[model samples]
Every structure is written in C-alpha cells, then in structure tokens.
Target: MAIDERSVHGGAALVLRLLVCVVAARAVSAVADGPLLNGNFEDPPNQSQMSGSVVTGEHAVSYWKTSGHIEFICSGQKQGDMVLTVPDGSHALRLGSGASIQQQISLTKGLYYSLTFSASRTCSQNEMLNVTAAPVSGSPAQTGELPTQTVYTSSGWDSYSWAFRAEAGLMSITVTHNCGEEEDPACGPIVDAFAIKTLSQPEASQNNMLRNGDFEEGPYIPPDSQWGVLVPPVDEDDVSPLPGWNIMAYKKSVKYIDSAHFAVPRGARAVELVSGVETALLQEVYTTVEGSWYRLEFSAGDADGCASSYDDGSSSGMKVKAYAGTAETTVDVDFRDAGGSKRGKIEFRATASPTRVVFVSLGYHTKSDNSGTLCGPVVDDVSLVPIPQPYARRLLL
Candidate 1:
C-alpha cells in the first residue's frame, strides 16, 4: 500500500512528541534527590546474622561510619536493662560514652541546607546528643545541642532541625552522645531519621532579612481578631514576643492586628504599635552583609473602624525606620486610606552585621467624641532585599 506524504510526516511528529515527553519526565524526577543511603539505619538485609551490638570502623550501612562504642539496633531489639523503645522503623543507633555515628556528604559552597534528625532519651540519666556540621575543607563548624533530657516517649521521638550555610564543597555531620562518663557507659542517647535537604535560593522580591516579617508566626490569633493587649517591655532583651519582632510599648501594651477584623495587605496579621500612645516594634536583620545596600518594603494603614471616623479631629499615622550603627532612614506614612491601601519603601546601606528595622505608631487620641477607643497606625507585610551596586547607586542619585 502506498502511504501519503502527509501521513508519513504525521507519524514522525508523533514519535518526536513521545520522545520529548519521556525526557521531560526524567528531568522532573531528577529535581528531588533521595535521602541519604541507609539514613534510617534500616537498610541492608540482616543476612549476615549480625545481632545488635556495638559498631566500630567501617560497616554495611551506606555512607556511614562508626566510632567509639556505638550500638547498632535491629528490629524488636530492646536496650540493656531498660525498656527503651526504638524511635523509628526496625533499626536505630544508640551511642555509648564517647561513641559517634558520622556521615560526610558533598554539597555546594555558599548554599543553604537543612539537617533534621529524631532523638530520644535512652538508658542513662543524662540523655544528651550533639549534632554538629562543618565544612570538610574550610569554614567554621556549628553544633546543635539536644541536651540532657531524661524523658523518653513510649512510641515516638522528638525531631530536631536547623538550617546552615555550606562553607565548602563537602560537609561532615556527626551525631555524638556526649553525656560523659556515667554509672554505665553503655547507656547513652538514641538517634534516627537522619536527613539533609538543600534549600532553594530566596527570590529577589521575597528576600526578607527579618523572620516572620508578616507576623504570621508565634501566637496564633484568628484573622480579623485581636491578640488581646501586649504590655510594654514585654519579652525584653533579644527575645521577641512576636517571633522575629521585639515589641516595646512606650506607655502600654500594643495590640496585635489580624486579618479577622481588618484588611491584611500581606499575611494573616500585622501590628498596632499605638492604641493610646507611641509603640515600637524592632527586628534585627542578622543575614545582612556589611556595606551592602538593602531596600525595605512594607504596608501601612489604620484600623477599619477608625479609617472613616477622623471627623472628630483624631489623626493616626506610622513611622517605618531602619538602622545600621549610626546610619538610619525613616519613612512617615499617613493612615488616611485605612485598611492597608498604602505601601511604603526605603533604602539604606548596612553598616553593621545585623541591621535593626523598627515600626513606630503615631496614633493620637481624639480631641472630640469619635468613638469608644482609638488605635495607632497598622504595619504589615515587611520585607528587605539586597540592592545591586548599580541599582543602589541609581537609587541614591
């Protein structure tokens, strides 16, 4: 049978489409890498008939090695003289005095990664484990302490995680039981569910130097509701009552605004710095680079109830400010629109390791009769991003 020229071309096109689809599927699969080999300590068949015992030097668990007196647990194995349960699967690694299980993995330098693991107390008094990571070739090491807990869950374990920046092409991570010499050196801590994931780079617009900038974290207040009253000097020092923000009231506690009662420009919540007097909210930008220029963006407005009731001569506004050492910049926002219709921005070069960003309310009480109570300006959806040198110069000019 003679084939038409058009039919021949159609068959060729169909084959090409199928080939492209197969290639795209493989590419998508490569985006997510698997966990570390034997990360759960349950891999490799128990065909060797090796019972639960102390591990030292090289072993069958992929990408892992042992040091000191480490106990390799198997399915249904119980700790010595105690009824400590395994935290995961059928296997867990228990560390005795000075024992450690370590794994070294290759990673990209200057990239961010998150390491997470499950830990629980074991047969000893001081159930302490130190999980640490450092560059194999250069840079400093960081240690996270899961310290001194004598409590153990019957079935589950507490998971701990931390984020770090890679300083070199390879990083070494170790889980060490550091309870020191106790009555029984064999009784130490337990570890399981080890994992490491590379974090994606932050988008230029979403690169916020402050944590919980939108006031979404910390205490949960329903949207459009109030977080009650937060008194002044609340959670002083470096600690923050609102997660990343340290709130200070010049006269009284400020109100935490949620979208439940008002309009939220960014996230679920914002802050009302002044209900009756001036209030300040500050966050230290620890990720800022010295001498680098950064742009600050935020939304400012007033409570919906007071937005249309300025006829009594009561006025409300906000001041958004940033400071790095002695250098600082401030932007004044008028709450005339109410309910977060205005966006404010400012740019400054960082002079310190961590710059301080502050939001102050300039709300005033009414001279005449307007309503029962009045509130200050609202601040929400704050973000900071690094400005390139050329862009920074243009902005300054």
Candidate 2:
C-alpha cells in the first residue's frame, strides 16, 4: 500500500510519542524513591543534622534518627557550595553569603524548580530560618534566584516552600541569613535537610487507598492505655500535649480505647451496646505493608451514657461517621451493639486487612439529639506489629 504524506507524518508523530513515553517512564522510576523513608528511625523521624552556629534563643538538640542527614553543621562550612547555617539573633536560622547546597540529580534549563521542607523547633520563638535557592555551579542566565526563607521558630513544625529555575546540571540549594549588610559571624542556622523532590506534574490519580499512619476514621488509640501510643490523638499535631493519652470516645462516658496503639491501617472491629447511657467509640488507622503482621489490643471500660439533645437543643444521642483522608470513600465503620459483650474490645481482627491507611477518625453521629458527650468503649491499648507479608493465614483475634 502506498502511504500518503500526511499518513507518513502521522506515523512519525506516533513513534515520537512512544519514544517520549518510554523516556518519561524511565525518569519516573529513577526518581520514584519511596515508601520514602521507612524504619530509618522513628515514624522514620528525620534525617541527620549537624550543630551549626547554635542559637542561644533556646537549647534544642538536633536529633538524627536516620543517616544522610543534609545538615548545615557549622558557619563558613565550605562543604557543598557556600557557607550557610549562621544564626541571626532575631531569627533562628539564616544564610551566610554564598551559601549553597549540592543535590544528587540535575535540574532542567530555565525550568523553575520548587523547594519545600518541614521544620520544627523545641520552643516557640520569633526566630526564623531563611530559605533560599543558591546556585552551586550553573549558568547565571538560567539561575533565576528565589527570595524566601524557611524559619524554625521555638514553636511547632511548620513548612516553607519556594521556587527557582536553573541551567542544565546541578545547583546548590541553600539557607542563609536574609539580611545582606549585617552578618552574625557566630550565628549559623542549623538546617535539618534540603529537599529537591518535585511535585507531580498532574495531580496524581492515586489509588493510595492507604499508605500509612492513623489518618482514617477508626481504630482510635487512646493514650492513657497500656498498648496505646498515646503520643497524640488521630489528626493531632505536635501542638497537642506530648507524652499524653488522647481519649477515644464511644460512650457518652469518655475514656474509650484507652492505652491503645492503633496499628497502622487499624480499624474498629466492635462496639459495646448498653441501655443506660449514651456510648462512645474509638478507632485508629495505622500504616502497614501487605502481609505484615500487627497486633491491635485494647480493653473497653464499663459502658456509660450521657445527655443528648436535638437540633432544637433537646438532649439525646448523636450519630457517627468514620473517614480516612477525608477524601470520602465507601470506607466507614459503624458502631453496633449486636454483641452481647458489655465491655467492647478494640483491637485486631481476622478480616478486612489493610496495607496502607492515612488516618482513622471516629466522628459521632448527630441527630435531633446532641446533648451529652458520650465517650467510652474505653480502648485500653492498641498496637500494629508488621509480620511477614501474606499476613497470618488468619487474624488472631
């Protein structure tokens, strides 16, 4: 068959598209580093860091749970690009002139590269850490600098993001003192790590059903229990009181799911039904890998109830809904009094195994009655222990 000119061009274009696809796939795989950081340390904690010019604002230690911490240890440290991590009394971390950071991969030409990182300090102070993209080795034409600084206050964990473009190859990402004229020779802001990870081009249509953590709407792990992480409640941030227990309510009574460590992907299995008072339910979602064996253990307390009122302000009981990612899925757990057990047990079950979960939230049901706060199904403990994949043939209830 004789091919027409247009047909020939179309064929060529198709081939080009295929070639581009292959290249893109390869790049994705090369950069697709993940479960990200697992087991390097706490919840995978944070990477390594060094004591640069320490801030006298407060004595906080740089914890290194994992290795390869891209830390700015000292002032005038000529390791990567320029000197960084000098302290400004007013702010906690800032840049010194010529400060930069080297990365593993090369950036595109004239394409703006964005940077984002999470930082936290022991205390809440006026201190700020300046974030900047310093050019390490690249053409000046394409090295459009970004003007923004990341600050780590004496407060909680906060994030800062900025963008910059570069010539082909690599460039140094730096954090330095924002003020150019005045320099604090003795001050260097300690950088936890510099991130070069790029955001997805298009919003990823991820089945990310559940990756890890208790971000869902169930398996609430109460802190005051034995097996509970008690670090904080689900969706609770660092601002939450540390080293304490977060109560999971099921009965209007309070203190449900006490001392529970809701395994990643952990879900509620049962609810205690009572006749006297309103009840509460606690659930948690923990992260886990497929076939990983984990344990969820908890002991419910003597059931209790409370006053309930309707939208009219009448007293009664409320309804409940559970969610993960708040992304809304068919994923919701309902509390049932079907079981004859008075004290409900919140822990592991045999079926409905989850590989990954963001978080588990237990929301109460609001009906015409929204009076007394029901809290119970006391979860004494919870835990998730990863076992070999395929999980045990049967969940050991």
Q: Considering every candidate listed, which one attains the maximal TM-score?
A: 1
Screening candidate 1 with a backbone cut-off below 3 angstroms (N, C-alpha, C), the clashing residue pairs are 223-259, 223-260, 224-258, 224-259, 224-260, 224-261, 230-253
Model 1 worst lDDT run, 10 consecutive residues: 222-231
**Candidate 2 C-alpha lDDT tens digits along 52-145:** 4322211122211111212324334443464333221112233333332222334555544444343332222323444334344544432222
Q: Which ten residues in a row have the lowest lDDT in candidate 2?
A: 33-42
Each prediction's RMSD to truth? 16.6, 20.4
Mark the regions of model 1 whose C-alpha exceeds 4 Å error after superposition.
1-34, 44-52, 80-82, 137-139, 148-156, 200-397
Against the hidden true structure, what lDDT does model 2 obtain?
Answer: 0.30
TM-score per model over all chains: 0.46, 0.26
